[model samples]
Target: MDNDEPLEPETQDEPETEPAPQNSDETLYCEAEASVAVDKDKAARESSETDLEIEDTEKFFTTGQRELYLEACKLMGVVPVSYFLRNMEESYMNLNHHGLGPNGTKAIAIALVNVSNNDLGLEGARIISEFLQRNISSLWNLQLSGNNFRDESAELLCQALSSNYQIKTLDLSHNQFSDKGGEYVGQMLALNIGLQSLDLSWNHFHVPGAVALCNGLRVNTTLQKLDLSMNGFGNEGATALGEVLRLNNSLVYLDISCNDITNDGVSKISKGLEVNESLKVLKLFLNPMSMDGAVSLILSIKRNPKSKMEEIDISNVLVSEQFLKILDGVCAIHPQLDVMYKSVQGFSAKKALLQWTNPMKLIQGYADQHKITVLDFFKSLNPKGVMTMPVGDFRKAMIQQDKVPVNLHQVRELIRKLDDKTGMVNFSLLKTVKP
Candidate 1:
């Protein structure tokens, strides 16, 4: 009994002590500390990766070259960008979406490299012009599209280009350069002898500027391809281009689409093609020309058996039976000649009735198709027995498919031809000979 009592007393006296329960806040603090340590390690690794990338980029240029670029930046009072310097050593430099303002642009231009989509304003252009005047041989292709270069900036660039002969391809598209800029470009083109391809598309060049540019092209002996699309070069501008084609022997490919050129402008171009033996490709699409103008173009090709015209793009101009016939004839002679055209002209119909060569044929075709006499159709349109109708009414009637269908331009031409001094179409003229 005594041994059992001693053992029980000893066990009661020595109650085991368990570890204190860990606090919730202490556990959270430990986890946060570990997370912070991991983040610090990751940041160190990222910093090392960035340093390695910089080292790799530095391998692209020699120490001397790097120093030169840095010195240029220092002299120009600009800070050098790491990516720009790295890209400058490559064959093609892509600086798109880089908000390189005027100062940044000047720094890049001093390096004489190709870049795009920079907001290089007038000051930037002036800086580049200074480099261009230096006649740097390293820079061959200059692409300044979508840079917001206005007339003044373009003028500065053109002046610089006048003395430089090393550049071969120059793209000044999608800029705000107007006629003043165009005049400057023309002057530069006249002097520069080494440039081969030029793109001045999507600019604000008008008749005067376009004519001036063409005048320069006429004297230029080196340029091979030119793009003047999406400008305001109207009939007079086309006339000047025609003159360039007539004289210039170097230009092989030309694009003058969407230049507000009409039938008269096309006629002028046709006249130039009659004697031009060097031009191979001509793009005149999106101009408000008709089948008559197309026919004239084909005939011009026919007249000049020596003409080297291989491709003619008039895809915006509609096709007609007479035009196809003439095209077939011309193609028989020039088997290599390619003519690009789209749908036939009409109001939702496949074949158009209106043709500038002969409006009477259109009237006769509709008259025969609807089984009505010309005089009767005119009377239906007039219906007043006054033998005359307003020009607008005649135009509306001519535009209807059930009636004498013609396009708006054809109606205007018809009105001009048939309307007496009273601004009214004489329906009675249907009975007389063709006016």
Candidate 2:
């Protein structure tokens, strides 16, 4: 009997009935017949379990996640605890999704210490918290994003991380953890020395929460990467993070994009960068920083020319040609730094028509290198202006030179839907000067 494979129902031809003499030998045959009947009944019972059904989820998880799930199932009496995990082991082992409610979570948590791809939404918060509280495993890598497990989940997870010595990464992004929840997470970070990465993006982390997080970072030294993007952390939060950058030596990557951070906040961060040396990558896209803030940041990095900091994202931020020229000269000299100056333009029917047909015209960056009106950056597309610029070529240039991650298939689909007839864009017709 192999444990890995389920027991199959037995199929043996029944023997024909034979007349027996009324003697002592007849008693032994009756006993043997009863035992055979019981064995046949047991096989039928086991075969019924193979009918268990489990649906597959779209998301896929790594091998470790699947192994953890299976270990838990086996501990919880693999046959009795059923939500189709046992039947469809190969197909739906990694996909623990919406169907698993609080009951399902509690059932699995009976044996599970680590879990992922399980969207045990609001209903499963209490169950998940209880599991974390009682969980015995040391190496815990929880990916509970999009669960909507608000304040309680945050506090519970914080408590778990505080005691657990093997916490590697805690990804709570896209949860309803506001600044209040963030405070709990920060408090935990101050104590937990084993945690390496923390992602709190797409939550409701504002100034007060950001302040608490920085307060934690000021003392803690294990965390290396912090993502606070898509939150409501404005200048006040940015200011606190800048202080963290100044004090914390372990942090290397910081993403603060789409947070509504402006000139004041950016300037303060620049001041921190001037004195700091550990940070290598900074993402500041979609912020409303003007030329002064941009210039201040460029000059701040120039002061520490040997700083390990190599990349800065200023895409969609208000930038002047002078700042672009200054940045281009700095990049040319260092050659180690890559200043991403991709300015994303909003959807425009007219602009799309022009950009699809001709080379794009912009104010700075590559265009300033040759002292040309940014159109020279895309000269590779057309040498004689005879070849019309298409979205495919534009995507290539954006990806190759500027390092803009634009998939030509996706970009082409968007452009084709916008202007199906031409299937081209003219970048030279970009509106450079405003009225």
Best by lDDT: 1
Tell me how far the alpha carbon of residue 174 in candidate 2 is from the true structure, in angstroms, after superposition: 0.9
Q: What is the C-alpha lDDT of each candidate?
A: 0.71, 0.59
Best by TM-score: 1
Clashes per candidate, residues 3 or more apart or on different chains: 0, 16
Rate residue 194 of model 1 by lDDT. Answer: 87
Query: RMSD per prediction, one decimal?
Result: 23.3, 15.1
Query: Which residue runs does candidate 2 get wrong by more than 4 Å?
Result: 1-135, 138-140, 343-435
TM-score of each: 0.61, 0.57
lDDT of 1: 0.71
Report lDDT (Cα) of residue 326, candidate 2. 84
Worst 10 residues of 2 by lDDT: 24-33
Q: lDDT (0-100) at residue 341 of candidate 1?
A: 75
User: For candidate 1, lDDT tens digit of each residue in 254-359?
Assistant: 9999999999999999999999988888999899998888888889999998887766888877787667777767866765466777766544442343334466
